[model samples]
Target: MNEADVFTMLRDTILAVLIASGPVLALALIVGLVIAFFQALTQIQEMTLTFVPKIVAIFLGIVASLPFIYATLTGLSDRVFDLIGRGGP
Candidate 1:
């Protein structure tokens, strides 16, 4: 592939990854921030307190967003395959 093709592929790959993971990452960030705020308000500085809720929230987010994520990945894969089939540069 040429330089432009390589860059385009790389950019597409990164974008696909971000789209796939965005929901879970965003949920984790929100949960972490909320937990941190709660901890600050209560003066309860427990490490595990942050971990469990974030994990649960992320897990729930993944479950909830599974269909959207699947569709995005499938689309990306189809496009990549189409490129390959077309002998893309």
Candidate 2:
């Protein structure tokens, strides 16, 4: 592949990675923030309190987003394989 084609593949790879992980990461961030707020309001500073909610939220987010993640990865894999099959220039 030429430089432009290589760059395009690189961009698509990054986008696919983001699409695969974005939901879980965003869920963790949001959950962590919410837990921090609640802790500040209640003055209940328990380390486990933050851990549990964020973990659960991240897990649920991953489960919910599995299909979308699968599709994105599959699409990326197909494109890469197709490029290989065509004897990439």
Candidate 3:
């Protein structure tokens, strides 16, 4: 209802999103970096090499982290819903 409350809500939402995405993004980033490094050392430049592993890693990461992601998002939703139920001053 107020500027502070609005900003706080926005911050919480953004943080929740970032935290929820962290696992997948981090896995992809690490896999990509490792593949790039290997390619650099071996001089084997294959586009599929980068795409395939990252895809698999991301998929696995998402499956493995689903619960953590759900909890993070659910917590944010609960807070938001509770805020709405409280009514603004």
Best by lDDT: 3
lDDT of 3 by residue, 1-89 (tens): 99999999999999999999998999999999999999999999999999999999999999999999999999999999999999952
Candidate 3, run of 10 with poorest lDDT? 80-89
> What's the TM-score of each model vs. the native?
0.93, 0.92, 0.96
lDDT of 2 at 26: 88
In order, candidate lDDTs are: 0.91, 0.93, 0.95
- Cα displacement (Å) at residue 75, model 3: 0.4
- Writing each residue's lDDT as its tens digit, candidate 1 over 20-73 gives 999899889989999999999999999999999898888889999999999988
Candidate 1: segments with Cα more than 4 A from true spot: none
Candidate 2: C-alpha RMSD to true structure equals 1.1
lDDT of 2 by residue, 60-87 (tens): 9989999999999999999999999997
Residue pairs with colliding backbones in model 3 are none
Native-referenced Cα lDDT, model 2: 0.93
Cα RMSDs, all models:
1.1, 1.1, 1.0
